[model samples]
Target: MAATAPKSLGAGEGAGNIGFDRSGIAGESKGLLKVLDTARKVAKSDSSVLITGESGTGKELIARAIHRNSTRRNGPMVIINCGAIPSELLESELFGHEKGAFTGAHRSRTGRFEIADNGSLFLDEIGDMSSDLQVKLLRAIQERKFERVGGTQTIAVDIRVISATNKDLAAAIKEGEFREDLYYRLNVIPIHILPLRERRDDIFPLTDYFQNNLLDRSTDYQIKQFSDQAKQVLTHYEWPGNIRELENMVERISVLVEEVDIQVHDLPECMITPSSHHTSSSVSSVFNNGIGFNEAVDQYQRSLISHALNESGWVKARAAEMLKMNRTTLVEKLKKMHIKPEMETPIF
Candidate 1:
């Protein structure tokens, strides 16, 4: 028989919930909205969920949301970064170890499954796991039972599994890198997170949300407006790094551009340049003879400013010092280059 569903499922309460707000998942994209709705419905059931997305697309967050909205919200939610742990150590980490199980096993350990009993176990970057581990994981999921290293007693687990991966598991299976049976077991309920680029509508609201949230923390700047030109530039730039990149950019601009209202000229050079899609030919020609000296310098300056902003975590004064430029001079350059510190809400 299937495991019993936890009471209060879909009510969004408990430690396993991780405070994942439904609003965070809401987006302008119809596809995303549909996905969120489906996720919500699935959360009501006790089914394993497999989230697939690009590296920075917030798969973990979605998993948390699912767990929070699920019946097991009150239980512990354990997260295991499969890629971060070495293959040699992964088995012990997931299955725990008994005293004297192997070298340095002085005491018994409770694995992630045991810790997350009756809750959720998020296996992040599952694509990076080895085939041996995959077989172990598959057996554990099928029987909900595992044995600790060097221990004969069978330990039963009552936890839901949520696995995430950026890599194409089908391709990995074809390449003999991943187990096909494990893939089928994990793919019972699949949810694909749309990248920020695909859901442009969320950009502006997310920017505003981050800005307002930052300001609440007593940031230096009191200004909270973006110029029309600045908005255009932001919308045009192809955000390869997705929402995380956009968030970083907004925080940088918020602290750097001091004006009550940000304008187009306050944008970074990369935003204004026609070459959002920089070709190798363009890069080579632009720097080969050091020709277009002005443009190259502008690019360098923009990069310097961007890097400073990122390094300083979007604090303008710190970024200014890092850039080795006077605060006033930095502000002037920003204006001249049409680099706006404030980004408009992205419309999907």
Candidate 2:
């Protein structure tokens, strides 16, 4: 466990950082700090924990932190992404399978539960688990014992479970997609990580750290700095993809931009400008002119796209980000609207 979290979101202060230095979780916002505090407090206990957050918020990092700080630190910290494994094969993966358990069961293999005995199990994207598997999982957690597939002997595991999800489990329960009883069992201690936009203060510090380390390790590049304008633009932009997006952008800039200082143009258009959905006086002009509702909406979209292109140095890829749109979707819109060659030089 980290002795203390950095007081500021500067280059290298990690407060209560237990297991995330190698995983790239950098932030000092109140929201992030509070979550770390909660993680620290809960790590001392053996109860199941549920971490909820948007994609790319580093839920797995928190799970590892808990495990590292817990009494089971020396034991194996087994991890399984519930959403990544196929539903048909998930059962065998969780509980060991005996030889001839199924068509492809060539040999008896130990499963995650058995491997995680006397340790911790990190289950990511728990919400995506199918209802059928939910019942078996519930029994395993409640009873702390499960039989291997096609095997009569029961396996007992003394493991701590930490689960993460991007989905709203309550809504899933209300709709009968997830079981209510399972939800209660998994959500013993909850940690909700705020998205990057909500904790915008961490952007610059995270970028600084990611850029320095990413460049220093790269054979093709050297460390680079961000211009003040570039930093401001990044700070103002809403990072829909959160820390993962920011780290990726930093790595891209370090490798792609030759300059020692990263300029505004070096960033992806999405990070330099507000999403097109924000309030804009330029878009309001159509309505001020008393134009038809449909026509006004159409004009607004075109104008926004055009402005995004201009701001993005006529780069369609960056423009699409500035517009908060998929590149293919933007291309289709441009084709339908007849965006002129003079306005946008089409580049595949």
Candidate 3:
């Protein structure tokens, strides 16, 4: 069974202020509701917001909602994937430069910040930013001013900064990988996203949504429904890639399976049998005749933890639900197992 919604939602009116229509999103889980609520409340304010979650958890959608709801909705909303750009050219990409600033500088170019004037700038995968660039970003946020690479004049921007990351920034700060001051500055209001596995109640709804909304029209395949057994299999199996994986699986089944209802046989091969679900079991049964009971238990635990972590994109709270444990207990288990809650590489 899926867990309850985050406790933050019931504490005050602010928790209940998520303005977006929950019915429109993929799933009907409490996690989805809470995220929408948090996004709504944060949207009303212009303060910097740092959205943290595993990849494919729809961080960009939340950012877009915030931008659309904010006072700057009429203006443009520029998105810059910090991890996608080369380190050498990031500075120029953020702050425009005059002609001849670099080898390929043919004309005066505008950066994301300048183009996003009177709007919002969304910096995705911000954890991958270099330390030197972090200093420049801090300066810009602190002073609301920045200068192009080769320009003499200072440009003042009236824009809101919204950043998202999939790394454990706190741990990064401890290791001196991320700057402490910069972290605090961007984390003015932090929003955490729950992964899909934690909210099993929303699985059927999400599957239906994908079938109705994302399926290709040209394909002659009719709408498919999940059988009760298939639903149980989905709920029990670990979702490593969160919603994106689920969406992909659904689309794949839609294309390959001819029937209107999806059964256990329609699932991917790895998920069909209980023994094939874990790496150790498949190895042990074939090579060692049978594995030790304790080793099997450990493998099971590891599989559960890994699945939950992947489904929730490594967010601890959501992973905890996927494991059917309390958040604090899950954190303790992670520590004991030496499993880091956050992904090492940036996942935005």
Candidate 4:
């Protein structure tokens, strides 16, 4: 079963359902909501939409949502990854070849454009499309007509185009890698999605959504809750892989973690440990300060203790367990370092 769509702030509030469906999407962040609002308005028309974002930022999801809520909802929503297919074969894939048009062509095959007649065609990773094909695509978009490869017949399609790309098309045009005219045609209605790091508020909500989906899938699956420290670590770490990465992590935790409560240690080591970039900065700070090695080590120790205490909610026993030290030793260190619960920020 597919995952249920998580609640948004105002999916259809004042709009009154003018072909707006937020199915399979899960986020309440303002950035995401603004994108959805624009999508809701655009779905009513046949305007071409170009979604730009990082690889895992769910550009395809936005495309699908628009298609589902469009006037051609009954028609098929055909998807083609321009980047995944090789340049030599992509032409035939988009505009089907006739029988014996190319090697291994046993019979005539229908292309994505023809199959998506009276519907929507999603061109994923459109930036990776070769310049030679861009000219044909531009003409097809402008006239809604194209001839199949090695065939003289011209087929017309009444299709709405939705294209998505992670690459910078503007830069590609400047570099002469992408056609400027084609870019303008595809980007009539631009929707740029912000990466996950910029929209941190959606992290926990998305995490919960993925966990709930897992619960729905199996009776033996126990929903695991992230500990406060784990959540803190998750929020602090930069998710370079975005939503896709988060979903993968949730699945990994569900399969590997037997306990219902997920601790910070249960997360990937990269999140728990200080990154090399941060460690280099720390070393630079140590040299900048007129402090000895001993003082630097003490400062690092204090930072770890403070982070552990904060993660443990200042409970001495839990904090000590996190640090793998005796409660009394942790208390003595706390007193020696003059550590207090008031220190809210983790120095590291």
Top candidate by lDDT: 4
Cα lDDT tens digits for candidate 2, 29-119? 7778888888877888999999999998879888987887788989999999999999988989999799999999999989999999999
Q: Candidate 3 vs candidate 4: which has greater TM-score?
A: 4
Instruction: Give per-residue CA lDDT, model 3, range 10-46, as digits (tens).
Output: 2123334445433335555667677777777777788
How would the candidate models be sorted by TM-score, starting from the highest?
4, 2, 3, 1
Ranking by lDDT: 4, 2, 3, 1
Clashing pairs in 2: 4-15, 4-16, 5-14, 5-15, 5-16, 6-15
Computed on alpha carbons, the lDDT of every model, listed in order, comes to 0.73, 0.77, 0.74, 0.82
- How many times do residue backbones clash in model 1? 17
For candidate 4, the lDDT comes to: 0.82
Count clashing pairs, candidate 3: 2
Model 4 TM-score, 2 decimals: 0.78
Q: Which model scores highest in TM-score?
A: 4
Q: For model 1, what is the alpha-carbon lDDT of residue 331?
A: 78
lDDT tens string, model 1, 5-65? 2222223322233333464543445546656666777788878889998877778878988
Worst 10 residues of 3 by lDDT: 2-11
Please identify model 2 stretches exceeding 4 Å from their true place. Answer: 1-24, 216-222, 280-348
**lDDT over C-alpha atoms for residue 165 of model 2:** 99
Per-residue accuracy of model 4 over 1-348 as CA lDDT, tens digit each = 233453343345423343467766777777788888899989999999999999799998899989988899899999999999999899889989899888888899899999999999999999999999999999999999999888899999999999999999999999999999999999999999988866777898789877875333455566677876577557655677999999989988888888888887788766655655655555654554345689678767866888789789999999999999999999999888777773432333
Better of 3 and 4 by lDDT: 4
TM-score of the candidate numbered 2?
0.75
